[model samples]
Target chain A: MNDTRQFHLLAGLATGRDARSDDAIYQSLWEAIVEHRLSPGARLPEDALAGAFGVSRTMIRRVLQRLALEQLVTLRTHRGAQITSPTPSEARDVFRARRLLEGALLTEVVGNIKPADLQALAQIADQEHHASREQAIRLSARFHTRLMAMAGNASLSEALSQLISRTSLIIAVYGRGQAGCPCEHHTLIKLLETHDLAALQKWMHEHLTGIEASLDFTASGDALPDFEHLFGHHREQNAS
Target chain B: MNDTRQFHLLAGLATGRDARSDDAIYQSLWEAIVEHRLSPGARLPEDALAGAFGVSRTMIRRVLQRLALEQLVTLRTHRGAQITSPTPSEARDVFRARRLLEGALLTEVVGNIKPADLQALAQIADQEHHASREQAIRLSARFHTRLMAMAGNASLSEALSQLISRTSLIIAVYGRGQAGCPCEHHTLIKLLETHDLAALQKWMHEHLTGIEASLDFTASGDALPDFEHLFGHHREQNAS
Candidate 1:
């Protein structure tokens, strides 16, 4: 398989920087990778990425660096960059860390969640319920962020956000890529509504464990989960 | 006060790039600020810094970017960079975050501590006992990393490290520069030594609160807390 082919074909015909922000490029790339439109081991060559995103190499580098910082990409010296293929051990570590943090995060999130925040959360669930599967997935991921923001600890939220990106990469590389399923959001949301802090915390832990269990890290193979369906189908609109 | 003079005067006669690395430069600069030789609001012009550190403008920018990332420096668009003067609210936010993470971190650390790790903690305390106050301060700060490293969560440790650096900058700006008193380290080490998880956790909370209470955030004006005595007499070796 051509390592760069998936990213190259997905690049589309973006031309010029006037309209595309690094953030837009970053989000599109982020969506593409998580959704599996851009598969694991896909090359992120600067020139190709620059042309693909309608930005300069410097701009592309900025995006790549951010991805690299989060371990979504491995920027090699002369080898350019590729989506991270986490080893089985690394896959386990990422999930372990996630469970530790999110489990701890929920105690405070539940204790501190106000009625207005609960209503906003119900609104998120409504949006997820009404939206397409892909949008549901995106909303589900955003649900966690909303919870974190409400938790009111910038440090924990920031840490978990980075871990979530890494978890997406892990799912891309190791887990089945059905990462955004809306299974646990409502359970926690309902728990929060009733002010059941203990169960909310317990539910949060199980939710993360469930996510980890979905990854087939026990079996050894570099299989590509289908991209278009895993994350969402927003790329056609997002690909500049 | 010449804005650049503090850093400029502290910039030693570094000859060329071959003589120094960015890490070395960063450590020197870190020690200088934490030790109070380079006061808050000190200007860090690229050329002067480049000349002083004997590195490329790119190298200097890399170092500055790191310090900026750690919230020790503020990189304005065209105004260049200055050591950050964190507002009182930012100061409080940092401590609040620190208290949450550290308290959470202690439970895991105590559960995971190995005999060798305990010995290493003792050794760190011993070094602090014998070293100069500045070195003791540095060691005390490092003791936290060692504890977190043993906790074995890279995500949590990484988050706390960034918070610690920001906390140091907060202390530099709002608290006395004497931020590294060896107050909490040995006590926590003792608690960990005895495997007292509950006390360890409680101590970590009070430890952080005690540190926060030590800062004088409500007082007005940006007076340079006389750098030498506040931190230590370590600058002659570190000023460059």
Candidate 2:
């Protein structure tokens, strides 16, 4: 019994040690936002968050600052941080910018894609198609993100990443259940593998247009959940 | 004497009111970075800057965070912030991304240019041709920035603004003064005015290529004094 307990303790330590503080926080917050676990306009209190994450407020502040920079969170003076809730006009602008930036990225990387990259993208598409839970949304978002990454331009990739995050925010606030068939990804991969730059560009543009057209921008105040439920974990920990 | 004092007071108020704050710091810092006033690896101390700007540490932190988001500055855990000195490879990647994004912007906006907007762009080129000293460089940079702005996408405009600022930083650090004639701007304006979309796109690609080819990229340690003098006023104010 003593040996088993010691082994369990060592295993837990190893698993905990593998998680870098910042990355873990970033990933958790990102997932929370993407999964709608943390709703739009929900405040992220640094001290409470620090307590929940078993880290310092400084780390939470740093991660929140990074999120603010990405426009995923809005950092206001004295009021603290909240998940960004993009206005309708801002949403339209986000998609328009994505069309331009992602279109260019697709055009550049289409001709350069290796068979392995195409296969990897196909796998993402497959996962996105079969995904029943919230992971589907993230996988769907990552599909375009991975394409931008494959372009191998760090600046463009970083910009696209921010745009994609904001896009997810917009979707969370305004998305309608206009789900359709998921064959667009396969078609895109085929076009890319065939080295058809013009077709790839057209398909990518249409893909974004289709996604934007599917959004419901009319919803307003119904977007924000009450602060208590959204941030209950922090409140509970603080109370404790 | 009363009138004169009031006038002096108003002027002083205007100057003091317009004095650098968080609202203005980002642009000022951007200018400094582009103009090589801030060298890569130079530390930005919050207390020192807050005292200099007559603002709180919060405001300084906000501005530095903005700069870091633009990749113009790097923020470390305990080491404070420093101007980003991108590697040569990063510089190349910046240009490549510019080519793709700006090229697409040119293609899309060429056909949509209003006659008045074209005339305004031509006027800018005319001013650039006659500009002396820093006005010339400022005008030259504005020529490209204005074109992107005219594309009617705020997100693209913002991204391009950051790119231009970074390019200026790169030039200040590595440029060898291989300045060329300003004919390309004239030609680009002519193509746009003539509604030659294909030619406009081609000219833009060539223009960016020409600018890249003209970069000196050989200067070493030229950024130190530039940054020192640029922020020296703030230092002196604090010291006094």
Best by DockQ: 2
- Give the Cα error of residue B205 in candidate 1, in Å: 1.5
- Per-residue alpha-carbon lDDT of model 2 for A1-240, expressed as tens digits? 112232222123222653347766777788777766676888777766665566676777878888887778899988999899988888888888898888778766965687788788899999978886576777777888887888888888887877877877888788886553367888888788788878888987888888888888766734554577568899789999
Q: For every candidate, what share of the true interface contacts is present?
A: 0.29, 0.75
The TM-score of candidate 2's chain A against the true chain A comes to 0.80
| TM-score, cand. 2 vs. native | 0.75
Which digits, one per residue and each the tens of the lDDT, describe model 1 over residues B70-170? 67788887899888877777777777777777777777787797989989888998888788865665676777778888877776677778777667667
The local lDDT score (0 to 100) that residue A169 gets in candidate 1 is: 66
Clashing pairs in 2: B37-B227, B174-B217, B176-B216
> Which portions of model 1 miss their true places by more than 4 Å?
A1-21, A114-116, A126-137, A177-179, A220-240, B1-36, B177-179, B220-240
Q: What is the TM-score of chain B alone in each candidate?
A: 0.80, 0.76
| Candidate 2, position A96, lDDT | 89
Model 2 per-residue lDDT tens digits across residues B56-90: 77777878887888888888879889888776677
- Chain A TM-scores of all predicted models: 0.78, 0.80
lDDT of 1 by residue, A28-139 (tens): 7876765556667877778767765555787787778777766777888778998887777777766777777777767677778788888888789778878775456556
